[model samples]
Target: MGPETLLPNGIAHYLLGGLLIGAGTVVIYGATGITAGASTFLESTLSYVSGLPRFQQFRFTATRDWRVVFTLGIVLGGALYGLAFGEFGWTTDVQWWRLLGGGVLVGIGTRVGKGCTSGHGVCGVGSLSEASLLNVSVFVSIAVGTALTVQALGVSP
Candidate 1:
């Protein structure tokens, strides 16, 4: 009645997927000695554009070559998942500007906070990084506050 009620594949499938992700993370760490971070993937991709002086300066593309491939794999895997699940056309009833603003805010937050959820929550926490712990605390706090504010404003689902 738990995951069976929530998903057709049930709890075992969820656990197996999580295990696979954890194992993959471990494999990545063992091979590269680097934590997986999605924002850095964006950085790597942005480093290609000649106009982006900041990305050009950072040289993420040069240092993170394999991660570019990893990021591309992630994108492709997501597309494959959407096709398999048949939810490719899903959308939120929000304005395009709202989505843009949110993306911008997330980019800013990742830069200021040093990393995003995959880096801090998964790999960093696994490594017992103090900064990651603090970052995660602030992240959860802000998320809770935002959810509460939205609920109070009666704009939540």
Candidate 2:
């Protein structure tokens, strides 16, 4: 395979993407003192339809409007990228149920860990939070171990 097959946009695309994420994270935090976490963004969106006290918390309800915009940006960004780059549709043969199960486990992990990777790894670590540092370590270790274990078990997509 050629470099194009491996990295269509080359290293510059990855570098630019990381820079954009960092800059956007910095800008959002600077503007509102809020970390750009997908999990919390999702929770905030729930406030619009769910009356649960957790969802109705001042933090989620008060800022949900902008959170919705942020969430939409995430979705639209991927959609636009796919449309522009011809990368749409499923690329893996993994079963849908397995994907759903994995998502459910990740959701639980976010709750138990008290934050997702973006929350802990990006914002929390940037601010030098000890918990975030530890959480990111655990996340990375578990991810690596899981991949190894799956490969050992002869798992396929």
Candidate 3:
């Protein structure tokens, strides 16, 4: 059967996509025994607990201080790959404030949904949890609605 039903289209897409993603995650983890990504785990934990605060706890638990280092490594790796393939070159200037605003929105959304996309849409739904499906539905709906509203309002992305 097609991966759609009477349920919300976003929910169905997330459910099916999550299952496939989860399976892939299992196979990868089975072989490597290491996490493929850290954002989901970090966001989920931040959502469920109270203390110094979810974000603070996430920062400490997820070692977010090292994220900069990891990001730098990724950039360096990309640069190296580009150099090797004769693709290295300057790119467009980045808008730091815009990026920071986007990051803030993502963090807020993750907290509201009790997980990031990876957590609900990939890991949770992968396990076939009804809760994950619901969360994904809400998340996708809100995101799409917001995007459309922004566009309608002539807000530049």
Candidate 4:
């Protein structure tokens, strides 16, 4: 196969998306002194409905508003993109129950890991945080292993 066929189309779109995410992360930190991580934002948004002290901490409550807005922006942005120019349907053959189970496992993993990839990979790694670096390394290693194992098991999706 030629080099042109080796790469997917819309490569520029991916580049632009990455740049925008990085820019948004920087702007969020520069303006509000908060790290723009989705998992933390998810936790902070729980402050409104949950009475749990873990979600009611000063750090989460103090910046919950903007975090909520940021989270909304992420959801809306993806929706907008799909509405504008993309396959606007669920094309995956994966079952809803499997998806739900995977999401639950991911949520638990994030809590145990203390953060998600966006926190450790984007903001933390950008700032050269040791803990973030370590977390990201483990994240990548596990992800690679999981993908390989699934592929070996003939999982197709």
Candidate 5:
């Protein structure tokens, strides 16, 4: 089955979102000469959060405050989209603690993986980087395995 039935909107709606993201990626690269990646943005935000001068000296955040703005825009865009769709409800079937725990694990995994799926799968692979190709392979394999394992265990997460 196609995503049309599973999604709240038509395929065109999803396509538009993809197009917008692609345009944004191009714009970011054109403006900053840097491929946009969310994880690195978060890492920089964390550096600022920790209030450590050493973290601020890191190559990631040393000269890239715009990344933090880009990250905030991403988050704000998501919130605005949900509000626009009138589907802004956040009543999840999963427990809060489970969600928090999962978020922590994902954060850890992103650091260990050196980037998130957006970095490796979207930008890196698009750039034809071999390391990103390998990372995407491992990421997809593990994600598929996890989904299948959850299905086997009848877990709803």
Candidate 6:
């Protein structure tokens, strides 16, 4: 993109994006005062068990025990945000079998790809990682193909 396109009201869009991400991180930290990434939590847990000297004790404790509370806050925050945006709703007619299958597929895909959409699409892409780029490309392509397949199968909306 050109400089002109990148600039919004005399401020760079990239700068704004960075500021927004930084603000989110700060908000999470202010609310919980801990890093809020799943990968970091997993790594910290592994390090705690593996007897890694480089892994600080406080980091391990902060991640392992408090992650549940942190995650709950994230969910609550998302729900509140959705409500504010008028996107909050309750669905009582969900297909449990389909949901189970979809969950299994997502779990397997996350394992195979080494990350979920938040990890790869948000964090990885933001950090300009090549693996994230490839993973996202595969994910997008597969998603499109799946949508096409489902449509072809005449699935009801």
RMSD of each: 3.1, 2.7, 9.1, 2.0, 2.4, 8.2
Query: How close to the true structure is residue 97 of candidate 6, measured as C-alpha lDDT?
Result: 84
- TM-score against native, each model: 0.80, 0.89, 0.50, 0.89, 0.84, 0.59
In candidate 6, what are the lDDT values of residues 59-93, reduced to their tens digit? 66556666655556668876886887687766546
lDDT for position 121 in model 5: 74
Give me the runs in candidate 4 sitting further than 4 Å from their true place: 1-6
Whole-model lDDT, model 4: 0.86
Clash number for every model?
0, 0, 0, 0, 0, 0
Clashing pairs in 3: none
Question: Stretches of candidate 1 above 4 Å error?
Answer: 1-13, 51-59
Model 5 C-alpha lDDT per residue in residues 1-157, reported as the tens digit of each score? 6666688576787889888888888888898787777777665766766777756766667645888788789889989988888767776898889889978887887788888877777788989999889989987898889889999999984
Against the reference, the lDDT scores of all candidates come to 0.81, 0.88, 0.63, 0.86, 0.80, 0.70
Stretches off by above 4 angstroms in model 2 are 1-9
Cα TM-score of candidate 2: 0.89
lDDT measured at residue 20 in model 2 versus the true structure, 0 to 100:
83
The TM-score of predicted model 1 comes to 0.80
- Over 36-143, each residue of candidate 4 has an lDDT whose tens digit, in order, gives 777887778889899999989998899889988888898899899998898488878988988898898878877888888788889999999998999899889988
Clashing pairs for model 6 are: none
Worst 10 residues of 2 by lDDT: 36-45
